[model samples]
Target: MTPAPGGFTDETFAAFLKGRDEPSWLADRRRSAFGRFKATPLPTLRDEEWRRTDLRALKLDQFAPPAPAEPSEAARAALEPAYRGLDSLYGTGIALVDGHAARSPDPSKLGGAVFVDLASAVQEHGELLKDLLMTEAFRDDADAFAALHAACWTGGALLYVPKGVKVETPLFHLVGLSAEGGADLSHTLVVLEEGAEATLVQETIGLDRGKAPGLHVGGVELILRRGSRLRFVNIQNWDTSTWHLSRERAVVGPDAALQWTVGGLGSRLAKVNQEVALVGRGARAQVNGVMFPTGRQNLTYITRQDHVAPNTTSDLLYKGGLKDRSRLVWRGMIKVEPDAQHTDAYQKNDNLVLDADARADSIPGLEIEANEVRCTHGATAGPVDPEMVFYARSRGVDEATATRLIVEGFFANVYDRISVEPVREALALAVAQKLELGSAPTLASAEAAGV
Candidate 1:
């Protein structure tokens, strides 16, 4: 068996297996992933996907899996407020502290749903784990962080939705990354069988008092079977001193549909890759994202819409706001295969720059192998329209308030993509909070300053 690499050490893998009571098959898979991990080197700026981000300062060998976290009374009290509205949106809620499950989730309401940690799933659903882990669900060659996640993942959250079952509340999975030179490889897989419908929410937060920088490699997979529909929402709020790397992909089967909405807020440096495939006819997909950056943080987004079947449709829209010296880069592609005769795909990326030093880049392209297909792609990177800013200021708004209004208006389109009111409102609130703390000044904070 191959050993884990980059400070994980063979001993660490063995210890992790023994501690978790992992089955033999699961252990063997982890062992082989280490080999695959060693075969693939860490990604550099030379890599096409990572061309815009700098990695020379990052040393993967410097970090290690953290010891379990034990939150204080105050910490627990702080988390209590975030848990109240979950029941309205999810059937079962799983909370992960550091890299382990902190509380047992009651899956009784979810008849066909299986919600558990990666460690537990390996033991209970060995065959499933062997079949799905690191497969086409996650395309590792696109980025090295994905391969590293496949190899060093110590714990994760896995959600399985059985056929024909509709979940009322979205599944809420909270992953907390504590400091202490700690590293977390958290993975989430959501499978919706034929004719099923569900909504899932994955919330990531980083909290650590240590001065040492941490790392988070997250992978989430969503599979929509024939005639199924899935609405996915991602909320990323990492610590300012952490490095966040994530890849989210979805496979849409015949007559199936997928709607994805995302918000990127807190991170010293973050890279998110979102990919969707129209593998069968009559498949529909909509991808939307909103990002807010401040200080010297950097945000990079890469998206792909792959069409393999006729009559497939996909639309993508992403908006970002950069402030201070923060920067953002967006690269997106739409690929139509020869067999895809009547595919309809659209891609758009828009940026709202709030300051002179802030920067944003957009790369949008389309590859078509079929002449009958209709495809359009465009990208725009510019500051807020001066006329709009002036109009807002003439209505009694200050410069900061005018900029905030423009940025908020820029993201209005993404918010309109969601069909659910409560969910949309929740996401709007989260986006607003991030922008207030990030680029725009908050009303409460501004009033306090005025006082």
Candidate 2:
């Protein structure tokens, strides 16, 4: 196998895996993944998917694999509120700090279900993990970052709900980073058996305020069996000094339903690819996302909806607000198979430019091979309307207040559609904070301020 570029190499990966007592099959899989990572080149601006985002300034050699560090009192204290709020709203909570499982759900609450650290899951449910892990959602050859994640992933969570079981309360998973100049590669696997139902909320946060940049490459695989239902929400809030890249995919079985939501509000640079495949007849999926990029952040998102069987359906909507010199890119595609008759799919993306220097790009596409399918896609990018501000000001509203109201209304269409109350409220607050810090004053600013 060829040697890996930068500071990552086969020897480095082998040493990292040593003494872990991992199953031989998993060890071989990692070695194979490392070979793929070595052969795959880092993406460049010339690549079609990477055309809008540039990573020439990044130095991968400077980042080293994460080493377990004692969680600091201050770091734990700072994250207390996040954990408390999640636990209060959701009945189950799991916290991983610095790629270590810091907190997990009790066995009594989990019952026959499996909710534990990845390492433990490997020992307890090796057969299940081996069969589903990295099998479909994330492939070794998907991309350079994905290949690297497959070889270097360390701490993660596994959630498995058995057949006919239904979890009434929601579950929360938190992945946090505190070590500087280190990298955290995590994996999350969620499986719901036939007739099962569950709700999962996941969040990634950076707890350290370090000057040096850190790295986070993560992957998520979701599998739903026949007639299963899953509601998933993911919130990303990494520190400004971190670079985040992730890939997520879900496969829905016959008559299964999935509701997936995502919020992006952190990281210096983030590129995420999220996809869902309706592989069984009558499967359905709904994907929604909201992002707020400020300062010099660069955020790119790619989504795919694949209808593989007849009578499948999918709907997707994404909204973003950009400020300062930040840039946002969204690429979405919907594909219907030749046999997928009566398929229904729709995708839309909207961007709100909050600053003159900010930029937004939206691309939507559809690939259909079936004649009896209905598919539609649309994208829009523009600044907030000044006339709306004027109309609000005419109603005796202050300039700042009017701009805030308009911005809020612009996002309310998406936010109000989120089914989870806590997640919706939290994301709304995040957007408000970004607007307060980065939103440019409207035409009413000068007149209202008596300038």
Candidate 3:
């Protein structure tokens, strides 16, 4: 059937699938997902989950599906600085420009792991891809945007770690969009087998502020098998003209552990939903996030920690700084099922307002069906402490400098909680850049100097 006028049609989706020459199963999956997307109406402000975030200004019909394009000199030049000194921080790196694989990782460094483009991996690892892609952690019908993602996702990343293997160095995947009025639909699927351990860093960047608006719909699904461990970091730095929406979920098996970190510093408007499910006994998950929203940006984040089995534990902490007329909304929830008797879950969201016009909404919730579970949540949003600024000013710091120091210290807790040094340092630098504190002393450096 043809798509509605000005909206993406089933025929267009079918043509996209055919152009990719994807596997039959994937084509079928796309068709199914497309049908779901068609059936599911666009989310409106009336929806509970979307009531706080407004999307009426967005014109989805203006954006077309992204196609592979050679990275312009300007795009390449802009991306180079982000990777300037990151070479030593990652053992393998993959770069995607405008939803195409621009640089691939070295096969030798991958060892037994599978690190390849999603389209290529679909052909190489058909059975495994079929079992996990768009089916396990993230469902197609989860939301209208999710179904649209499953149907139109283009170049993406797939990382699979075999059992008993431990990747010492981190793997980095960079996805960038540079076109105007284009849609960047990408998916990232990471599977860690039993007893495996690995760290992955994924960064999304919009290199161009196109004349017309752009759209980015992305999905990430992470699976941790029994006794496995994973540390995943996501950094989003889209340009101010793009509308970003994404869903990320993880499932942890028995005795598994997950450490997830998120950094949100860009995008004109973004709504992200992230969740982690502890599905087996002795599973543990820790989530830490840092966000800095400036200009007129509006960023919304929703997170869930689910305990489905006994003896599972989960902890989450998110910190954000809002400046200019920027606004942020954070909703965090912790759920304990009836069978999760020994569950322990905690969630907190803290926001620092850096300007009078800046606004923040922090909401923390808990759902407990297990009487024996220990579940707690808290949220706070306020300007930087005047007492702290006063104290810093007394020490010869200017007001802006003092506020910057206070803001840095506000986010230092989450950064300290993260285990990877490189990731922490990179995030700190990014945050400093966002705060316009290029030459200012960072919390880490200040602490090192006994300040």
Candidate 4:
């Protein structure tokens, strides 16, 4: 009902709001965010965070907010291994079709947890939503995308686990976008109270690929209270023609532990910002990332680890592979506040380029104001080792198979750090499929690589 020519203009923004059925508070928030979006300009190559990234070809006006979509079996079927085996891993799940929620868990199955679409949470859990949504974990109008997402986001999910509730089964959020799903502006908010524990898996799939180009501007906020533990895995697998942009942040509280894993393998151009803030003593975070880009795609990740409390610890590892004309970029930082003494942080990013035309860029940094902190970072980018391929070929594997095997070995380390069996399998199988391998990586290859 909205999103005409000049998709993001003030006129279209007002039209978008006119079509939504939201409350006064939400309307006010949208207006404020749109105001900020108008005041802020889109990132350019001149900005520090975007110096290596360019958006000169992106025309936001060409994309419209996705209209509510009907679930299609054909679309789901097209996702193959990425969407496969999901039903067996979760006790309950939320499915979003073309930026609209298709199904939600029965409230009784939540076991005292609140897993519902953000649209409903705004009414059923307004007070808590008001206090936490965009207030704690990812609060900022840093750029145009952030503000635009806050202003026009829809078809998102919220998971709020009560204090002391330990959900043994992982929860799933799956999104399927089709050719007709013009634009996806979804926000995911996950909140775990004190002593609570849960696992949440978020996945995005491009159903009916090679249709019209698409756009996704997404946000994710993870909030863990004291002593809580959370495991979150994000799978981003949109079509190569889509423009994918996202911001994600996690706030870890005292004695809480967070494990975040990511799989990025799709999109024409992606620019993501991921950050973690340790706000309490004894807090810990372990982050793992795996990215494989093929074709002419461009992928970039900007990550930060913020130590805000004493005795906080953080560890991060990211692995990437580039093929064809694809390019990958990683810029990472570890920041230790003056008050956060005894902080321990480490970050590393490694990339493998498989083609002469492909490129990879890795940049790691540290900003420490604390005298008693240990922060370290490392990065590496290069073509695959020729000797490894030669060895594989000497062992009777074909050159192509050998290359795939070596690439598998390259990602084995990060995969080992992932605790979820299904997630690990899905990411591995998805990446393998992208490399033209079958459903699962070869066991011989796994053993040869010592995975």
Candidate 5:
């Protein structure tokens, strides 16, 4: 079957995949995902998840697939106008400029590691990719954007650590969106064999500071072999006018643990699907997510903790704050299969509303087929405690100051889960700055001092 004019087609996408030298299995999967993308209509309000998000004005047809690495000086300069010093903890650094990996920075000085751009690796490491790329081990479902990403992704990163290797430093990947009427499709695959441990940092940003609106669609798959550990953080600070969608999931082998933290502070409309399956006994998964929305922006976050094996545990905590006319919806679920005995799962979603005009929705559910399993799910959506705000204002704090205090306290729960102190401080300062609460000199000093 063919896609609509100007829309992506399986034939074109399949040809592109074949040109990348990908294995026949991956190419076939891309074709199948493309067919699904063509058959499944664009989500509208009629759908449960898309009810709060309006995509009519997005005009996704205008975005052309990104070209190969031939960026103009202007585009190159847009990459890093003010160089952010490289992190000493992350040995390898990769930059996805426009929609391709611009250059391969040296990462050999570090320990045993494999880091390469997806497009480049397709040509250089086709065999290894076929054996370790996006497998059905991660998740079996894909939405529209995920299907599109599978079909048309041009750039991303791949990191692999062999067994018995420990990476002290994280792997840093930067995905940049710079061109107008262009789409950024990136696919990140991280694999850690048994006895391997590593951390990954993913940053998505827009080079266009103007009002131009573009599309960022990405898919990531994480595989953790037995006795491995992985920590992943997604720092999304794109242009406020952009529309972004991402689908990421992980598969845990026996005795493996995965920790994920996400901070969403940009984009006019965003949808994120984060899930993980505990396929092995004693596997653990934890997720801590925080989002603050202002203006007319709207954000949707969905998370799933599926236990297919016995004695697995998963915990999730997601917090959100909305001001102005913005809105946010958070839906989470924890499912235990029939034979998954002794599985423990917990899910909680809390939202603090700062403005009367703003809105927040929370839906938390659980499905347990085993009688001996332990599962609990809860959701809370409401305004800040009026008594607490009044007490602060009664002690000489202005209305705005008191309001910011309440908001900060609301976010403290999720921010504390992040082990990286510098990023946490930076995020807190950024959140305060966005709320226009710069009057709090203490916040600036704390952030500057990296306390």
Candidate 6:
């Protein structure tokens, strides 16, 4: 069997599994996932979850799983431009090029935490990953992209904190792609045991302009044990040529809390599913998102907050801005089970359309089986209030500066919820840079904006 050049065929999968000298347990898991991947069909317009997205533009056959990651000086330098001020802000960090680790986590700052690439974790800490790897966050009958990610995922990380450990300093990860038409399948697993606490921040860098048609199928699993705490932030900043598809899920335990934030600033098209399950009493979760799409880009994010136990609370907010002919879609749901009494849940999504041709869709829903639960959801999408722009412009701010100020204030709602100063500042800076919204307070001629 040999690998395919244009697609992931049976021969390619078989050859891939054979080349890796993995233990039987991991090999068997991959094989099982491969079977599932073969059975599940690719997403299409007919699928309700994918109905709003433009499926016709995605040419899945054009991307092929990339070869194993190898060291490259150019790759390292290419990644440096993104995620500025990372070294001083994070206690430990990992830089990956095409899924392979270019820099591993620092030993000194781990503070007895186990931070290693998934492959190494499989070899050195097999006991820790035995039953907790993919079982907690994913199921056997997952979507095609998720199943394929489980089968072909190559370079990712696993962070495991022992009971009673507290890693006060934030950890960092950078994911980058260097080759055009290449596919990267990376998986992240984070586990915090009883009474443990940690924070993780992840960012992605895609192939530069003139680089086109890349693919990313990724997965993330966060498992929190009793009385634990975790704060996670992920910023997807791939170039406009990349098609990003990912499935992320987290399970919260008794008395635990999880704060998850996301920033969607790049990618030609991105569809993501993020879910958090509160399965234990007194569990809590907060989700925040900031998304901006421009230049014909399309971005979609779906989130679910499931409360399965009594006395659980969840709050979610997602804000997006669109320009050019770009489009943004956000759907959120909060579900409370019959036994989840005293559950409190809320979700809201808002979008600002900066161009007449640009479009935005926001949908919020609730499914509650508990009589005692309180759940509320709301969604709003419209162009920037001419009144707000006018107000800002009245205050010595030119039109460009006024619009920029309005956009920043709109997104600041979520930024204020981020608690971590560095993460908040970095995200704000990146958004300003990507949108070219940072400049002197000139008149910002409509002609300059291609009006």
Candidate 4 per-residue lDDT over residues 1-451, each given as its tens digit: 2235667877778877887777788889989998998899899999999987889988888876554334465654543333334544567777776666666776666788999988778878888888888988765498999999988888789999999998888888887667666788888999999999999888876766575777899999999999999999987877777899999999999999999998888888999999999999999999999998988889999999999999999999999988888889999999999999999999999998888999999989999999998888999988878998899888899998988888888999999999987777667776777677322232112222334
Please give, for residues 1-451, the per-residue lDDT of candidate 5 as tens digits. Answer: 0112354554455445545655666677777777777776888889887787788888866564554435566665666531133333345577776676655657773378788888778777888888877665433245677767777777899888899788887667777777543577888899899989988777777775487667788788889899999988777667777788888888998899998888777777898888888998999988888777888888888888989999999989888877888889888889899878999899988888888999998988888889999898898999888898799988999888898888888889788988766556766776776678321112213356444
**Model 4, global lDDT:** 0.83
Query: How many clashes in candidate 4?
Result: 0
Candidate 6 local distance difference test against the native: 0.81
TM-score, one value per model: 0.89, 0.93, 0.93, 0.93, 0.90, 0.93
Q: Please give the range of 10 consecutive residues that has the lowest summed lDDT in model 1.
A: 439-448
TM-score winner, 3 or 5? 3
* lDDT (tens digit, per residue) of candidate 6 on 204-276: 7674435556788989999999999999988887777788999999999999999999988888899999999
Tens digits of per-residue lDDT for model 3, 416-446: 9999777787677777777883222222222
List residue ranges in candidate 4 displaced over 4 A: 1-3, 67-85, 437-451
Q: Model 2, poorest ten-residue lDDT window?
A: 439-448
Candidate 6 Cα misplacement greater than 4 A, ranges: 1-4, 69-71, 80-84, 437-451
lDDT by residue (225-332, candidate 2, tens digit) is 999999999877888888999999999999999999988888889999999999999999999999889999999999999999999999999999988999999999
lDDT of each: 0.74, 0.83, 0.82, 0.83, 0.75, 0.81
Residue pairs with clashing backbones, model 4: none
User: 46-140 in candidate 1: lDDT tens per residue?
Assistant: 98878898877777666644433344444344344445445444566776656766655677766667778776887788788777776757875
Q: Which runs in model 1 stand beyond 4 Å of their true positions?
A: 1-6, 66-79, 85-91, 140-143, 208-210, 439-451
The per-residue C-alpha lDDT of model 5 at residue 352 equals: 85
Please identify model 5 stretches exceeding 4 Å from their true place.
1-5, 9-29, 81-83, 86-91, 103-105, 137-141, 437-451
